[model samples]
Target: MISPRVNTRVWQRSISLLSPQAAKTESNVVTKERTYIENLSKDIATSRFRLVDENGKIASITVQPDIPICIKKDCLVSIHNLNHLSLSYKWLNFWSNLIKFRSFKSSLFHRIIGSSVLEILAAPNFQTSRRPFDSSRSLSVLNLTGTKDWNVFGKDSIIAFEQNSSLEIKSPIFPSARSLVSNSSKSQLPRKFQILNGRGNVLVCGGGLVYSIELIDESDKILVNSRNILAINGQ
Candidate 1:
């Protein structure tokens, strides 16, 4: 019987022929990916709110009249009102109105109003986290329909709201005698709450990432620390 010899050279040749094609395919994929990333970065740069860093952190926000924004007075980098949008403010307290701290009564302002565009930037030192209101994530956006009510813990964190929205500063509800005596921590007690309701969006600034959790039914209940609360839906 004659033994047939295997052609090792043929196998080597076949592999050599396929290597360049695989390398070219990989290079094409990498080039396409890089192009996509560049295009996405350009789009974000031209967007209304542009993130300053690669980490999706926004350093400045552009305000449009149709979508007004409220921000802390200290966080204001610059205000350009070329369109002459209505700029107004609400007093956090009677004293705040009378004193006019920082030439404005309150710490927050409605930076945009009417049919024009406005541009504003966050201060470099400003470090508060900004996120859209999401109930499931324990976040709250102020939207008042006049039918529902929101109890905001403090006025300082409120950034902005719709032009039509209304805010009522109310004294904190008195704690029960038992709570007063048993609760040693004064911070746990209610101090003041801003009753907010209206027909537009409200921007709130939180110390950290804003999140919210919703209660589905009457049986669903959770006790949250008062200091950590941003806002509560009174509905």
Candidate 2:
């Protein structure tokens, strides 16, 4: 299969954060109502998927059978041709307004939200958009068939990824800040880097252009910030 090409606009000098008014207008936040899965897939060619573009154009990619992708449950537009898809709770936040998991690894202490499935009339496109950042970069899907691992990304960086995968948190977050905070403070918060393991595909929006750096082995670790990451597989 051919690799998909995504169109990118030149980077802006400064980006504006979402305004309260704009946040209020989004249907994703205002409504908990979901579209029928069968209905979403039924007319997927021209209907169902909604991009962040003002023109309402939709982009789509196909997922091979049993290949589970990770996505913010809210960003999911539609999925088709597969059954037996499962959901595992990733994490929850009482501190921030943004809750980051539609599918996340289980943690014992987080608050659990009740679940429901979003589907449409037909096959659905796994659609997503940039949030709390560059909201215009509508959708970007990376096929993991040829690659082994990906970079660690911000919590919001992923829209959807392969379900078979797992994520691990890395340590010693930043060099300069290591001395700034006490070791006890470090234990209180979440770890710095998250490693994604397992197989199948991962779909991500890196906010601007998405780049993949191929690593040949375990010792080849890339020292980078977590926010800049998209996804990674293997140790």
* Clash count, one per candidate: 10, 31
What does candidate 1's lDDT look like per residue over 84-109, in tens digits? 56655544444443342233334444
For candidate 2, lDDT tens digit of each residue in 180-234? 1333543212233334443333344544444444443333333445545455544
Rate residue 49 of model 1 by lDDT: 40
CA-lDDT, candidates in order? 0.45, 0.35
Give the best candidate by TM-score: 1
Which 10 consecutive positions of candidate 2 have the poorest summed lDDT?
A: 106-115
lDDT score for residue 45 of model 2: 18
By summed lDDT, the worst window of 10 consecutive residues in model 1 runs over: 14-23
Candidate 1 local distance difference test against the native: 0.45
